[model samples]
Target chain A: MSEHGVRIQLDRVTKQYPRQPEPAVDNVSLDIPAGELVVFVGPSGCGKTTTMKMINRLIEPTSGEITIGGENVLALEPNELRTRIGYVIQQIGLFPHMTVRDNIAVVPRLLGWDKARITRRVDELLELVGLDPSAFRDRLPKQLSGGQQQRVGVARALAADPPVMLMDEPFGATDPITRDKLQNEFLRLQKELRKTIIFVTHDFDEAVKLGDRIAVLAEQSHVAQYDTPGRILAAPANDYVEGFVGSAAAIKQLGLMHVGMLTGLAELSATSGLPTVRSRENARDALDIMLRAGTSHVVVLDEQGDPRGVIGFEDIAGLLREEVSRVGQDA
Target chain B: MSVKTLDTAYQVTPSRWSRRNLTVPIGLIAAVAVLWLWVSSLNLDSIEARVLNAEAVRRAVVDHILLAVSATLLVVAIAVPLGIMLTRRWAKPLVPVVMALANIGQAVPALGLLVLLALWFGIGFKIALIALVVTAVLPVLRNTVVGIQQVDQSLVEAARGMGMRASRILRLVELPLAVPVMLAGLRTTIVIAVGVATVATFVNAGGLGDIIVAGIKLQRTPVLITGGVLTAVIALGLDWLGGLAERLLRPKGV
Candidate 1:
């Protein structure tokens, strides 16, 4: 499984619900890398959800192909394919009758895992999502708070350890504070598991916080732009992508293109004195200084306060310029 | 949440039964006493003898309660599946006709139904059982379908999103959520059957109706009152008990 890469690609996928005059998802294609957290974001009625649902055949494509782990999903039984892909939805639909532990064990039970292994997996997953099994196990869904239930929902989705996960607004139901906690917890989980993920949400902030690559879906399910978060913010493909990012394109670009990427470049190595800040300094500040310095990019200093890399003006200017013209049109 | 509802490991809340269990039966006995007093004050010559002798009419009451329960259990077992089947998206279109059949079953003169059964199958307990079962299906079937249909769509979506199989989601999430509605239907069906069962005794079935029928024959008020009191108690008791069971079995915390 490790050697076999999981890359999700949608080649001209189209979905038109019967009796509905317009297509929910237009012909669109996307390439998402293995072990990356990619997000598809758009307004409520957009086809972002339709695109995600096609991967495992929850909604069959009217035309085009979808492949997971290099295998065409249509070639496999839908139920069999779904079992290999994790799905999480907005309501955090925990089984009301099931205990927290049993709820988390849903997929593993479906897979027919032995009791001992399944129990261990449930406990491990409960702990990963920040719920103590000692306190939470055996408790029914109604006993849990909203945030806690969402954690269980995630634990359940990840139970089978599927190579890819589909999340549709998994945190949309929670309060801002809890949503942030869940988002961060998910980010940490993804870091450790590195499963290829396709997360759908309308929240731009959530998309920025969680996505490795961000695909902005417009009305009719068109892929306005699909690029790394930093690249998209720095360089939007069209006016739709620009408006979707909000008018603060420069600030948003700085939010993603950190000093780390600039420091990685070979040209940035010659400058030893780096822009020094606290360990907690914002990526925005590092970017702001790089822009003011008129270089392609700047270096990131360490705890000892040393120069890391020399950033060129292109690092800051290139993508921002591409997005700049479109930003006004959207505004 | 009851302490019993929770495991021994933790506490939830007091069960509603703790106090009511003590209060309800005691209250019923008081009502029985009030009825006895009211009747004794009447000085009705036949009342005492009719009740004390365990008149033949009182026999019908016991018979009816048993019929209602047995019929109810059978209907639940049968209708749940049928109801669930009817609720499937592809099968949903069939619901109207099935509902109409259930409605017709209920609309038939319950006595005529038994008479038909008696004429066809011979006069006895079996004929009455057939009539009662026919009447019971309307509530059970209607409730089952409604309960299944009422399951939260988002929960089903979430279950699917987690890659759960269709059958698994139906069994665990959909069924549990639909339980309250199903039980509501079950209760209504049982109550109706309990009332109907007494009338079944006219067809040679033994029940509270037997006491009522025998009381009228013997011109005995005691026999009639005793049978009526017990019949009422049984109806109310089963209704309360069914309600409690519904509350107890409902997916805890939901």
Candidate 2:
């Protein structure tokens, strides 16, 4: 099977529970391009999960249509459709009685893969999730730490290598440190897999960190604003989205930019004493270094730690201003 | 950490030869030996000798075991599937009604139930088997439902989300997780079966109950002691086997 994702389109989808006046998700429409991570950010009861579930028909829509890769979702068997879409949830529900190998092999076994191939795939997946195959293959879920179990959850979802993934706050239950670590590892993995993913979360900061596009949702699953993180932080479409962006919009915008984006940096000199920041580090980190050392400029280093050039406070500030005005003009 | 340390840290499987497992069998052997010695010491008259002889004692012991074991197997066959059926979404409404009937089966005394069955169906091993099954079915049936219900709902949803059919989920996920509790219930049923099998002689189904009934009617203490001691020993021995089956049959890491 090809590892790349296919486009998903939702056309005026609505979910109305009987006896409820307002539809849980009312006439929402969206288009998600292949190989992008779109986050659904909203309050607890805003029907964001309901909207995502309709893609795989976990919660069937009351009206309208959803298509993945241009085939109507409602036309296919739900079990068949779900097999081709990876799903992960906050609870990290690993089957307790099965060994890690057996747990990861569930989907492949369902697909009727041969025993040798299943074993090979289980080991490969365990390695992909950063668990040592020989050490962990025979262990049960309760034997692992919470972070480790969550990693296995992700690996299990990816077992069939589905083109689309739906994650509902997959890291929500972990401790803060573990959550941060899992997010970083997941981001690195996603860079390579490039599956079209709908990540549902209430945390706007998480949306800013991981989402390629943010769909800020309001009551009854209304899409308040749908844009990139930089745009949403720079120019929120309305006060509802502005409230979500909060007061730290400028700093959050800086976080979206890297030092390598800075232009016309002064050439580094051997005698110049300056703080050093990596080129891949975000602009916010460079600004923090300048603020701490009471210096306007810090030397930017490349991958080999060689001095590439110097960036000053004005350079970082200019990047943020340029982004804001650019989005402002678009609005 | 080294493999040695990891092994020690999660030493979940207790050793098969641990004290807890060894004690029951050893105590049972000692009890049997004492009972044998005590019986031999009694200078028996003809009636005591007739009741306590090897052929008669052996027949009674064999009959009792067959009665208890067959009844237990029958109870398992009837109860487990019914319990599983009751837990399904469409069958949920039947749960309370079935449980009430099972409760009534348990609430009636075993002797009374046996006599009633004997009156209706006439007396034999079959009547006694039905009586034992009716008396012991409640625990296993109740436990089967409870065991499946107690599995984490998220795990079921996870299985469903992964495209597992309902039957596949029941077989692979639900049933394996439910094994420990189901086996515990079976253990209780075994003990109940053994206790109730002694009452089988009341309906002309031969067992250790015959010897005890004869001793009481004939007013012979030696016969009573032999029958009573042998019945208790068999009960303990069967319970030990049940415990061992529970530990062995339970799915690993559950």
Candidate 3:
């Protein structure tokens, strides 16, 4: 199987537990490009985890083949193959007996790194995850809080710097604030690392926030839609996705895509210094730039950098005020 | 000459770091010293005479410790693997039954077990050894099973997914994490074995119990005190060692 860059192909994958009447995963086939963050989103027990596990052969596929980097994963020794791919989980299962350094150095040690190299790698990972290695190196898993431990978990997974990462709700167990911070931190990490990633989550909002392309698995592991976050939001493939995305599809779509791409040069001329509005004069991004900038009146510049639309605090405020007035009238 | 002088000075005056680390060791040695001194202050001639020509007392203490050590080592060798086996999926279903059996072994009177073993293996160290082995197995086995079984499931899954073979996972991850608790269990077993070895004198098993039993038969206080104090010390020693192992083996947080 000579393959293109990090292409993961799932060919007719199906799984049926012993004595079960139904297949947990139906005949599903998907092709994920290299260096993409693909989110597998679904309801509980819809086989998203089963599908993810099959990629690494953790759960043997009853019938199907998973190819990573153009090599059929089934051909590689499971342990040898798994060690080469990064894995993160919601439980953040840091080894209780191993210090943070040892935990992060696990794969490196298995691959026969000398003490100095393993130590250096561990220290590097701790810093990458935003923890100071000097303070945390000798500490045990039990001493850290949930969020800190999860950070270590992510750092440990990335220690060997594998080209691919499989994450199962890595941020799901964290509290909202910590989860948000971790999400942003992980995105930053991914931007730099560019590991081909398959991230699983039940949270659609999370899928929208993080995925380049989100694959919505409906009941019985049926693929409802596998498209860019924008396509899925702007034109849902089916009603299940619409109902599944529920009323928040628009809001979620806002996150899935870059505002700069959607807005034309014609649109940027209207919004004002939205102080938070960046120095960027992108036509599409000016809206967020205007909102976050919070300076009531804004100017959008044409290609010549001349003011085109003068958006006032009242126009933005009126949008909010209209909702308020509508609620007041309804009450 | 200055470097040589610094070396000499360092040897004579221990570093503060060394002193801090040695605190527990210092306290332990002090207690032992205090006990020895207190015993020495007792000027009772019978006891003093027995303690001075203490060949008999020495033999008894040595024999008791040897038997306890033997029992604990044999128990660990047998129990650790058995515990690992019992924690597997197929074997897991039999844990309650196996635990019931271990509990029954413990519930038997040590004297009764010794008699039964004597009938089976004949009188001597062998019967006593068999009895002690049976008595010591449960703690190590139970603790090993509990420790391995309690490893977080997700960690196991992560290891499995990473392609660490079952054997490697058991060796590198499962065993290391389980060690602190297992050591605690071993400590408990060793202390219990020392206490039990005393009762083996009934079967002509010459442990510290021999001196105590001899004192009872001869109506002598000196033999009894020597045997009793030594057994107490042995139990305390094993307990202290276990505590130290637990401290050393347990890691700080991530």
Candidate 4:
């Protein structure tokens, strides 16, 4: 295996459970680049989870190879390999008997981190996940709400600061409002961390919102199409890929752009009373703000919280028009 | 939400001297006091004639305590580990077999089991101890297996996925979650041991049962009451202690 900036590579991977006729995952290959979040989206029993679990060797592949950071994953001991990769699941299985601090400290402690470092890391993670260390550190999992527990689950997985993370519907259990809030927070966190992540979800919308590239999987874990969310939405490879893209592919394409990415900022002087959106917010959010304010333009704030530019209704409409025509040209 | 309301409800219940909290301890003390007065009111001459004097009662109680405690400790040492082992993959096939053996141990009457052991090992302290331990192992063993098995599989999976070794998972996850139910099993075993050890005196192991047997043979009512009261009090006291241990040892907010 040759090392590359690309973090994980799967070559012709296949998994066949005993007594089952067809393979759960068959002859699937993927390359996940470093510091990018790639989502594997598909319907029920599509082998999306089976493929993700193979990366951690939770479910070993019957054939083919996987390499992480240029080293063959199968060569490392399963437990040792797992320690180097973070994993979060939908159940948010925090150890019920452990305090939040202890739960977060699990991986670091297993890796033989000293007490002082583990303590610092645990508090850092609780804060990172938007949990107050003082209030939540000593509390058991049962004491926290479903959303809070999931946050702790994410923190616990991040404890050792592994370079790679595997998340399987980590936000699937919460109510829609909480789920949206968690997704937003998780996206913001991912921006700073930049770890290579393989996120598994059945929701194509979530893939568009979070994925740097989306791998639309079908039965047998076959990659129906693997491309950037914008490209997939603008030009799905075939009917199967288009079906998974959902009906509003043009609208989903707008979600891929931030307000900061839009060029030709109109004069901010004219938008003084208009609603404001953050530069880091999606173009869809900027459009929503403009619509709700009943204004032609909204002020876009940069990272420093200062107004950097203005995005008007025309910019959003222009972006959508470009997406529609691009798809038309590709067809 | 519901969790917030539950927290407030838990807080409203006072910690010290609450009726719910003090009921067991208070009841124990009152019962012991009444037992003492009744025993003291009995005719000393009749009790002495049946060999049920204070010194005899003291010796019998001591013997009974030793028998029950020793048997309980031995059972715990064997059964808990065996139960945990049974839950593991290697031992899974053996679980049904071992549980069936435990079922047979309990199915046999206590007196019959003791007599059977005596026939094999001869009527003595060793045979009596073996019988009591065998009879009492089932509850603790069954409870331990059930407790560990009932731990959420997701928690175990999460532990494994986090790179925790099997031993670490057992110590940090499985065992801790299993404590409450395991303690319930232990309490049952200890209480059973205390009651069953009285029959140990049949093989001349020397316990509260000696007085009861002597009283029955001699037709002495006072002696019988004294023996029964002493045995019952000890059982009650040990049971209360077990309850306290269970509460104190339980993980918070379980």
Each candidate's fnat: 0.61, 0.67, 0.72, 0.67
Model 2, which residues run further than 4 Å from truth?
A19-21, A267-271, B1-19
The full ranking of all candidates by TM-score, starting with the best, is 2, 4, 1, 3
What do the candidate models score in CA lDDT, each in turn? 0.77, 0.88, 0.75, 0.85
Model 1: runs farther than 4 Å from truth?
A: A1-5, A259-280, A285-331, B1-15, B29-52, B55-58, B107-123, B214-220
lDDT of 3 by residue, B46-136 (tens): 6445643457767888899999999999999998999889877778567778777777777788888898888877899878988998887
lDDT of candidate 2 over A1-331, digit per residue (tens): 3398889999999999999999999999999999999999999999999999888787889999999999999999888888888889889889998999998998888889999999989888888889999999999999999999999999999998999999999999999999999999999888989999999999999999999999999998999999999999998999999998888899988888999888888876662778999999999889898899999899999999988899888878888888888988988
DockQ of each: 0.47, 0.59, 0.42, 0.59
Worst window of 10 by summed lDDT in candidate 1 chain A: A273-282
Q: Residue A128 error for model 2, in Å?
A: 2.6
Model 4 alpha-carbon drift over 4 Å, by segment: A1-6, A259-281, A286-317, A324-331, B1-26, B44-48
Q: For model 4, how does the per-residue alpha-carbon lDDT over B67-88 read when each residue is reduced to its tens digit?
A: 9999989999999999889878
Q: Candidate 4 — number of clashing residue pairs?
A: 0
Model 3 per-residue lDDT at B122: 82
- lDDT per residue, candidate 3, A1-331, as tens digits? 1111277889999998999999999998998988889999999999999999888888888998889988998888878888888899888877776778878888887788899988888888888889999999998888888888988998888877777889999999889999988898988877777778899999988887788889999876789999877666666778889877879554454443332232222344434334432223332344455567665545644456555545444444333344345434543
Per-residue lDDT, model 2, residue B222, is: 77
lDDT of 2 by residue, B114-219 (tens): 9889989999999999999999998788878877877888898888888888899999989888777777778778888988898999999999999999999999
State the lDDT at A202 in candidate 2: 95
Candidate 1 chain B, which ten residues in sequence have the lowest lDDT sum?
B2-11
Write candidate 4's Cα lDDT for A1-331 as tens digits: 1111248999999999999999999999999889899999999899999999998898999999999989999999999999988899999888887899998988988888999988888888889999999999999889999999999999998888888999999998899999999998998888888889999999999898889999999999999999888888888888999999989776677788888888888776765587999998888888777778898888999899998888778889897778768767766
Candidate 1 versus truth, CA RMSD in Å, comes to 7.2
